[model samples]
Target: MKTETQTTGEQKGFYKLSSLQRIGFGSGDLAQNLIYQTVSMYLLIFYTNVFGISATAAGIMFLVVRVIDVIWDPIVGAFVDKKNPKMGKYRSYLILGGIPLTGFAILCFWNGFSGSLLYAYITYVGLSMIYTLINVPYGALNASLTRDTDEVTKLTSTRMFMANMGGLAVGYGVPILVQYLSPNGKINSPESAQAWFITMTLYAIAGLLLLVFCYTQTKERVVMDVKETENVKVSDLWTAFKHNGPLRILAFFFITAFAMMAIGNAAGSYYMIYNVQAPEMLPYFMALGSLPAFIFMPLVPAIKRAIGKKQLFYVFLTIAILGMIMLYIISVIPALRSQVWLVLVAQFIKSTGIIVATGYMWALVPEVISYGEHATGKRISGIVNALTGIFYKAGMALGGVVPGLVLAYVGFDKDNTITQSAFAEQGILWLVVVIPAILLLVAMFIISKYELDDAVIDKINHEIESRHKN
Candidate 1:
């Protein structure tokens, strides 16, 4: 019988993807991010301002939901890894999990309960869990598509490009659509929020359709050949963590970096509306955040080659931090408030740094998986994704928790109109600048710990290839 090593040689090359094949894989991310960014950017405001949940209550809910993810993510990961079905292991969940995820996403936007915290909890929790079921596998599926490093980099760039397209739609399009749907531009009334529900329902349905499209179009070319062990044991979780140094570093990086982005994006709506006094300008401001992806994303492979991944990361992260500081300086000065256009320009620069560096990190997951295989003979894509998922959820937890808590800390009153208290405005400023900046600095430190580079990974791949040859 021909062994796995011979197969690896045949699979190696940049010619793994046709242009159509790239688009198919990239579209899957476009689908997921449409739903994901909607939740990340708008859900908190939906809960706090529209659905009538208090900021503190919503903060607690955000923390609790992420705790649930810690338990749920691994179960889905292990299940996908161990059971190798004929329809392709991970792609199947894009449909299975996506259907429920779509429904819950719509329900989350509904204003029927009239300030009911209970309804928010049930629907939002279901949305979070179902998203995990789909997302963990989707992440694993990226590695399954090919073992070619350059091809995966190309795939990651395309995937992130598609994701930013979704981000553009959600960030720029959602607010405008919601306002247009509302009666007389009033968002405070229940009827106004009902418009939000309708808009999001359309988005959710579209998102699900895209998931099915991704499922139909994708194929898995390389997967671990393993005997089905017993159902995944919790003990094995510890084993995966104990021996896997690269996974640990990547996990920490995901937690801090994702948390920073999530918290910043979620809080942005409030900052624009309450602090900047320009709710109408929100979509444009948000578009600026994702729009730079077109400019910078195409350049990632070249950038990585010139500076190396770690150095490029450091450069971008520092620039992002400096941009935040500039924002804070501008916000506090009354003279600068008149220059809203200038503030937006600063935001664009900051976002340029964040969007490219963070988006490219998805490609690093395969590197960690390959590293694990080099050290131990196992290539468990699921367990690695599961671990990565935990940190992502943790980052999302902070993203969820921080804004609500910060709003509450500043004593934001939901029942007010036209103007907020000075304390509340101060809270909005902190959300916009200081908190995310601090998190980014922390992320820079965490990424510094990542030891794997192109040379190191290439050596590991050679060793792994030789072992399979024996």
Candidate 2:
């Protein structure tokens, strides 16, 4: 009788997951976005407006945390690759690291020690570090699930869809929930601290539960065996980085893509509240960030097949730039300035491009991982993910630093609360539109350097499997 691995097609190293299995895997990303997206899109605003810190100080703290991540992610990545736990390689972290990750995520938003940079630093740092523990392994988990390129695409599409569902919740639901819960029915004020804390607690708990679901659903089918894993070392991360050309290009792409998303996301609340002068519309505005995912993500497989991957990127990326340009024009025109509908429209256009371009990029990670595996004869998914994590954090560093520094330079007053000065509003505009537009251009260039098309990656996967068969 055949074993389950063979019955499921895993013995050939190209497993096809069930729809339920795919959704379970996707839940991991959804779980992360619920917590991390809350942090990415709202934490800066929370620190400045609610937690009582200057934008400059918050920016510095963000940079410091990323610097720490540069050191921490590699160690976690290398350690994960080297060890195999009884729970499961890679999948075990969904629960093991998730418990603490949820705690710190909730605590990061709490105002028990309000205005204490020391408290902010401690909680935020803990949150970022613990996030890496879960994020790196979760990233590796994608590649471990299957080696079939089409299945990987399907899996990535499902992951982005669910991930954006979490984004929509955080983006739209957080503010609405926070507003409903706040004593004053305001999301970005000192008075809303309790609401922020409570909201985060709920989201974090939900995220932890989803991680458990992901843990139950996932099994690592295409990973290094015992002897190959034993040879894994921290030094191997650097070796892979130097040798893996596609990984290098993809890493740069991650920095640009994430920085663009982070900068725009970080500035969104400020843009809605201050620049647009409509705090009531904040939820709808932020929700647009993820709304495109539901429409466009499902079309990614078809889009990629129709246009080819690189062309799909170029077209969507150009569309994103167009949306940014439209936004800048609307903000500057006196008549359009007050047109909320126009603002929302431009945002939708911009988000559509961004959502498609960036959302589809996750699919490339598996390709680069396979590239490294073909070259080295070892599948160090953990280490590859760690490298990507470090660069991804670097992009986030830019996202965090640029907004705070720009806001500080423009004399943004956390105390003012009602309105920012014209200069500050313009700075917020730059963060929302100009800077992100520039980053997209850079991203287009970097992705052009990516060498692995579908044909190339398919060939690589086939050759590796053939060697195994031999």
Candidate 3:
């Protein structure tokens, strides 16, 4: 068991994170949310409206990109872990990969080659790969920062708080901003591409600036240092996965949680535009989704202290499920067609639960890494982070592919300015409501299987530090 003195030190270190440092550490996530939400929320619409691709073709593209991820993500993970450069093993990638990611992101939103499949494929694929390069290392960078549990929580809360701030920019602000830029007030190809292009360039550039800020304010505290003479192998990945039970649990949780968030977010742009009959209100609706984080985030430590993480996840995930079901019912019933406030309220409720549940889980990565070290006598934070990255990206893939495929199958037309067919509306509802609800239910069950509580993790951390001291 950790002594009060050690725990206090951890708490102090966490509280000691300067605002600049907190913001810097948080910027990696901020950059990711900006780029990712842009892709997830608008890419399909961009394909249909601006580029003249069928919804089905876009959906197929979503799956292809994700399949490509399985091959790309792990390879990036191995290379980074093996090299362990001195400038900062994981943090350096934010600048190294970030430059290209920024350029590719802008290209993705460009409409110069409108209606060209090859153009879309080249930009989107490059953007996705570049994002992977920046993101995997960024995820690993969090664990490298510190090993103190309470400090990790503080770092996570602060990081998530900044991330939600970015979410507000992407989810709430982007639509309104882009529309304002559009000459005709409609976000279709040819006329509107320049507006999107300018907006995304601004976003990408801002994200790179944030990455630089993150690099300056942050320091690597508990990293697994690789000597200059050592070489890392891919087999080490398998060995870590085979032995690290907590890593395994967290990896599955990443898949389910990220997938749920991704699918729900992707479907939301469609739902508000088509079902709710208020495309202009999307930023407000998405803003509400992230707003709850501000209200509930400060309360996480107290909540975790009271209920424990495992129990807290169960409660909040159920709340999310119930909220989704209510939203689905509200969307389907003709009587509630004009109840935009009701939809917003449901979004807030659902978001509150999700914000609390998922936001706190990132704190567990360090805990699992600690557990792996205690169990295996080797501290391989990069490998552990890579394992979790694979599953999380897999979830993100599902989020993209399922909604795109479902909308395509239902005969959604990108070119139409008016309402879609009844079947298409139903598909939109299922994407926003039913499918995401089912995924959230799966998340609740998978979370139930996680065996580490606070006490167990604290013990593991204590053991690892003690052995290192010896």
The regions of model 2 sitting more than 4 angstroms off are 1-4, 8-11
Deviation (Å) of 423 in candidate 1: 1.6
Model 1 lDDT per residue over 42-141, tens place: 8888877788888899988999999999998888778888877776778988888888998999999898896898998999899998998888889988
Q: Cα lDDT for residue 237, model 2? A: 88
* TM-score for each predicted model, relative to the true structure: 0.95, 0.98, 0.94
lDDT for every model? 0.83, 0.92, 0.79
Show pairs that collide, candidate 1: none
- In Å, residue 430's CA in model 3 sits off its true spot by 0.1
lDDT per residue as tens, model 3, 1-470: 11122234453112245667767899888878888878877887888777777776777777788778777777787777766566677888888988999999999998888878888888888988888888877877787666667667778888888888888898888888888998977665457788899999999999998888787777766655456214555666788788877777778888988888888888787788778888878888989878988888878878888888888888888888888877987888877857898899888888888888899899888888778777766566666667787788788888878887888789887767557888999998888778877888888887787888777877777666676556
To one decimal, what is the Cα RMSD in angstroms of model 3 from the true structure?
A: 3.0
Stretches of model 3 off by over 4 angstroms after superposition? 1-16, 188-190, 228-231
Off by over 4 Å in 1: 1-15, 187-189, 226-232
Q: What is the lDDT of residue 379 in candidate 2?
A: 86
For model 2, what is the error of residue 13's alpha carbon versus the real structure, in angstroms, after optimal superposition? 1.4
lDDT score of residue 72 within candidate 3: 77
* Candidate 2: residue 400 lDDT (0-100): 95
